[model samples]
Target: MTELPAGLHEFLSKAGWEGAEIDPIPGDASFRRYFRVRRPSGERAMLMHAPPPHEDPAPFLLVAQWLSNHGLRAPEILAQNPREGWVLTEDFGNDRMRDWLDENPDGEESAYAGAIDALVELHRQEPGPFSPYDMPTYLRETSLLTEWYAPAVGLDVDVSGYDAAWSEALEPMLARQKPGVTVLRDYHAENIMLLGDPRMGAPQGLIDFQDALVGHPAYDLVSLLQDARRDVSEDLERAMLSRYAGRAGANEHFEADYARLGAQRNAKIVGIFTRLYKRDGKPRYLDMIPRVWAAMERDLAHPALGPVADWFARNIPDDLRKSGGGTIK
Candidate 1:
């Protein structure tokens, strides 16, 4: 029997779940860990362990309450020990949107449509209190590609030049954002859940949203449509975009914003995936880099990305673009 961490054991005991069955749940890229707890009465709950100095539970608690208060289906907090970085939240079950799409391939359209509807509804809400995803944030995120990924591919370019080019390319787009909406930085299939009933009002349940920010509405939309882990079919992507545009009353520059954000996001992911391998020793993320690069190429084709596209061409040779230990094409 794996002994529970001292703090976790104490927290469970204090929460009146002393004899509960605690089973470790699969983890994500972050430092946090999760476990499923089953009480003697057959009730289930989720225990989140985000060890301090690395991960904090306060942001999760704040965002979860804000989301729940706004009528969204974020998990309810049952108990908490912020100082020790522990949280007991209502169990949302194991029906992740990614698993649902895999199990029912033909249901992509409906699943994505439901997600789009939820996004539209979320955008309708008044902006919440969150950090703004401004030019500095955008630039810092994109720098990961050059900082970590460039060296991985054997190209040591000037970091200053790279930053300058991105600033030139991304500044105008960031400035034009219209009174930003609440942007869930990771709003893809893996972070979403399907509630499966219209009576529940919001058919989607949200998770992994502690990193929410106030940014362009197009940011989250692009995150869903151009997902790094899953292949969002082109047809479905277009359909969902149109759905969001109509429902959100998007302006003429929506397409430009979407494409630019997508390009910026993919660039950041490419760097992040590489760093995950080099710094964290998680090499599996490298396999996903090729797909991410392909997506970035698609986004960079947009005219607004000329400066960024040119930078990529000049710095990273075509053959060195792919990162997953695969042969450079």
Candidate 2:
């Protein structure tokens, strides 16, 4: 990026770093981009490439510092190029929970269990400076999934009822969530890493977290257990939930709230998968829509989601029970 930003190469050389290799990490929904830098001493660092005015690294940098101060391993910010909106961060490596799951299919539960612990620990952190992950913003963003599925396989049925059910379900559910510290908003498969530390425990490396937001306590849990990109087995999902519930000291009320929140999250994921396929031209996310739907259906079976469940039953096709299974929203 612009000839390695003059003087930086000299700095790297002086720091005993070898040549910088640009390993372009995959793109996320936001404008931010990432690259991994392999150093001479086997030390790896990541370079965030947010092209100019769109996304400032200030918030990310700020949060990283805040988290690290709390004894959390949120990449050490080694260097920065403010004008380019680029920052060099300690590489947590590529062994994300998802990668570990994919690469070692047998121990998925252990890895996920560790992730749940990390989330519980993350939530346990003392309240800090984090921005709100507004409910309105979530609602708006979640609609992208519905919007995506609506046109993908072509369905124009009045989704007003579906929308209404979502709103109804989220009202009490969101109210139950205590929006305390900055929730990483995304605490799912890809962001969490398997670390070697007993303290951070569970698994270790985490990435793709520039979109962190202070949000509902249930938000990140739902994000992890009901991931849009992965099919966490039913048994594993249950076990992980139990672990998180125990750590959070969640009671009956919290259980109900967690299930309801799961519904909201899955619904949002369904819409997001559809949107990724149709709008973002990223069909890789399409296949996972059904699982998201399945997760929603499971949650819909809960008594607390009666009205919403009934609405979905009456409107959405049984085959399409999970977001896009029926080729409609």
**Which candidate has the top score in lDDT?**
1
- Model 2 weakest 10-residue run by lDDT: 1-10
* Residue 278 displacement (Å), model 2: 1.7
* Index of the highest-TM-score prediction: 1
lDDT string for model 2 (1-329, tens) is: 33444455554554445497657676657677777778556668887766568888887787788777876668888887656676788887767777777777867766777777777877788656766666676667657645766566665655677667667776776554554655776778777767653233544755556667776677778888888778877888788888988887775677677777787777677777777666667767766777777788888888878877887667556655533466632
TM-score, prediction 1: 0.94
Q: For residues 1-329, could you state the per-residue lDDT of candidate 1 as single tens digits?
A: 25566688789999988889999887758878899999989999999999898999998898899888887789989999999989999888887889977887877888888888888888888777888898889999999988888788677777887788778877877766647778889999999987773223437889999999888998998899999999987888899999998888887788887889998999899889888888888888877887888888888898888888888778877666544323311
lDDT of 2: 0.70
What local distance difference test score does each model get? 0.84, 0.70
**Which sections of candidate 2 miss by over 4 Å?**
1-19, 28-30, 197-203, 322-324
